[model samples]
Target: MGASIDERKPMVSGFGYASHSSSGIGSAHFRGRGRSHAPFKTWIWRHWPLLMVGSFGAFYLIHRLSHMGSSTSAPKATSQSAQQLRSDSSRVQNGKVRLSDLIGASIHLSEVAAHEITDVKFGGKEATEVKGKTDEGVDEPVTLADARSNSVFVNGLRELFPGISILSEETDPDLEEVGISAINGVELTHDPWLDLNDILITVDPLDATKEFTENLLHFVTTMVCVVHKGKPIAGIINEPFVKDEAAVWGVALDKATEGADLRVSHGLQPSTEDTVAGADKVVISRSHTGSGADVVSEYLPGKQPVFAGGSGYKALRVLEGDANAYVHVTKIKSWDVCAADAVVHAAGGEFTNLKGERLVYEKDDPMISGGIIAAADSKMHAWYVEKLAPLQSSHGDKHRI
Candidate 1:
C-alpha cells in the first residue's frame, strides 16, 4: 500500500546529540578534606570580588574557546565532511553527492548497458538467450543487460553515496552478491535529518525488457529514482535506444509548477497545455492492455490509443506531447514508474493513482496497489480521475477516491 499525502510530508531537519557518562568522586571526598578547605576559604574571604571576577572571566574564556574551536576546525574538514555537517542539515542530509550528479551517473551507466544489449546481432543465439523470467512472474528479457546495468548502477551509487539503501528490480544472485560487497565498502557520514536506512534508491536498469528482446528499442529505457521517506525527491530516465540517446532528470525539491513549460537538455519541451481534445492521443502499456484500453477509449471517445512498452516510455510520450495521457490498470512496481513519475511531474504533468493520490516509493513492499494515470496537465489528470472513479470503485473494492 502507498502512503497517504499526510504521511509523505517532508522529514524534519535536526541533529541528535549522543549522550555520554563519566564517573566522578562523590561529595564524600570533600567531607574529610575540611582542613585543606579552611585555607582556601580564608583566601577567598580576603579576595572574594577578585575570585568572583576571575571565575566569570575563566567561564567566558572557555565558552569563547569552544566556539573558536568549532569555527576553525569546520573549514579544515574535507568538502564531503563539511557538507555532511551543514548548519541547515536538511540541504544534503540525504547524501553528500548532488542529485544532478547521481542522475548523470545513472544515465551514463544505463547507456553503457543499452549499448551491450542492442549491439548483439539480431536473430542470433545471443539474442534468443536473453529472455528469462523473474520472481515476480513477469517475462524479463535481457537478463545479461539487466544484470550488467544493475551492477553498474548499484556499484556506481554505492561508490557515490555509501550507506544509502537501494531497492532495485534486478536481483540476480551474482548481482546481489556484488551489490552487497559494494555496500559494505561504503563509509557513511552521520546525518540527523535523514536516516540512511530511510533513503532508498529504486532502479529499473532495463525497462521494457520484452520490447528490447523484440528489437523494439525505442520503447526501452533505464530508470532511477531517489526516495526519501517514501516520497520521490529526484529521478532520471534514460532512453538509450533513441537515435540521439536522450536522458532527462528532475528534482522534486525544485518546486515544479503545474502546467509550467519545461525545456530539457535533450531539446524536449514537455507540453503545458491544460486541455485535451477528442483527437488527442493516449498511450497505454502494450503488454498489459485490457481494461486500460477500454477506459481510455471510453473517457476520450475518439482519441487514439498508442500501444507502447515500458512505463517510463509511456510517461515520456505524455511528457513529450506525443500522447496526451497514459493509463495503466494493473499492479506496477515502484521502480517501473517512480523515475518517470518524477520527470512527468517536473514536466508540468501529474502522475497519480486511479484514486487521484500521488504515488509513494521505498516502501517495504515495492508493489503499488490500485492503478496509475499520467496526464500532460493537471486538468486532464483530474478529468481522467473523475472518469476512472467508477472503475476504481468496482475494481476489487480496494481503492478509495
Candidate 2:
C-alpha cells in the first residue's frame, strides 16, 4: 500500500502518467493515430539545428541568385550602349551629306597641289609614241619613266591628303584605312581622308614628263584631276611654268551647275571657245599616238591634232573645253586617275574606262591597266560610247577598275 501510494503521488505531481507502454511505439495501429505531422515539443528537440541551417541556406541562395542575375545583365547593357552609339554616328553622317550639295563647299583639287612642279624622277627608256598592242593585240603600256615620277606624287599626295589612302602606280594602300563604311564620319575613322565621302582623288601627276623633256614641249606640268566612281568629275591641268595658266573644268551631272563655282560657272554656258564636238579644235598629246588618235579622228575628222606632253596637261585641255576627249590607250593605275577624278566629280562630270564602265579606286594590283576615256558631260558619255563601243568590245573590253 505504501509503495503504490508513492507511485500515485509521482503521477499526480506531473498532472498524470501516460497510459501507453513502451510497446505502444512498435504497434502499427498506434502510429500517427492521434497526432499532427509533427508535434511542437518533439520537433523542437530533434530538428532545431536543421531548421536554423535551412533558414540560413535559403537566404544565401536568394542572395547568390540576385548577384548572378546582375552579372548576366552587365554584358547585355554594354552591347546595347554600343549599338546606340553606332546608330547616332550614322545619323550624323547622313545629315552632313543632306545639308550640302557638295561633300565640302567647292573642293577644287586643283587648289590643293594644282600647280606644284612635278620633278622628273623617271623616264621610261622604252616609252613609245607610236602604235602598240595589248592583250587584245597591238596595245601599248606608256613604257615611259612615269613609274618613277609616280613616287613623288604618291609622297606629295600623302602630305596633301594627310590620312587618306594612296593609290598610285608605285603604291596601293587599301580602303581599310578609311573604314569600309562611307556613312561613318571620317573623324571617327582610324584614318581621315583629305576629301570625304566616296570621293577618291586620282592623278597621273607626270604622265608624259619624259616625253616633255625629250620632246621640248613647254605646255606640260603636273596632271591634276579627281576620279570619282572611277570617273573624272572635275579636272585641272596646270602648266607649272605658266603661273595659273592652266585649264579647270569638269562634266556636269544633275545640279552640277546649281552650286556654281567661278571655274565651272563660266563653263556651264558653252562659250564659242570651250565647246567640244565642234569644228576648229585640236585634240592631241605631247606623247603622240597614231592608233588611239585615229579612233579620235573618226569622231572629229581633220580636227588639228596638237601634241602636248604630260598626262595631266593632255587631259586638262579637254576639261577646259578647249579640246575634246583624251583617250589613254595605256594601263593607268589609281594614281593616274584619282586627282583629276576628284575635281571632275566635284564639277559634276563622269570619267570612265574605254569600255564605258566606271573606274573604281584602290586596287591591290599596281601594274594593271585598262584604257581611259574622258568626256565633258555624263549625259553625252553614252553618245561617245555609241561611237566607241566597237573599239571597246572588239578590243576585248580590257578596262580595269
The lowest-lDDT stretch of 10 consecutive residues in candidate 1 is 182-191
Model 1 spans > 4 angstroms off: 1-97, 120-138, 172-195, 254-267, 274-279, 396-401
Clashes of 1: 0
Worst 10 residues of 2 by lDDT: 9-18
- Model 1, 66-133: lDDT tens per residue? 88845552232123221232221122343454444455556555666566555542325343343565
For 62-111, candidate 2 gives per-residue lDDT tens digits of 78878884554122112212122122112223222321212221122223
Task: Give stretches of model 2 more than 4 Å off.
Answer: 1-162, 170-203, 215-217, 224-236, 244-288, 297-304, 342-350, 366-370, 378-380, 395-401
Position 131, candidate 2: lDDT = 33
After best superposition, candidate 1 residue 267: deviation in angstroms?
5.1
Q: What is the lDDT, from 0 to 100, of the residue 12 in candidate 1?
A: 18
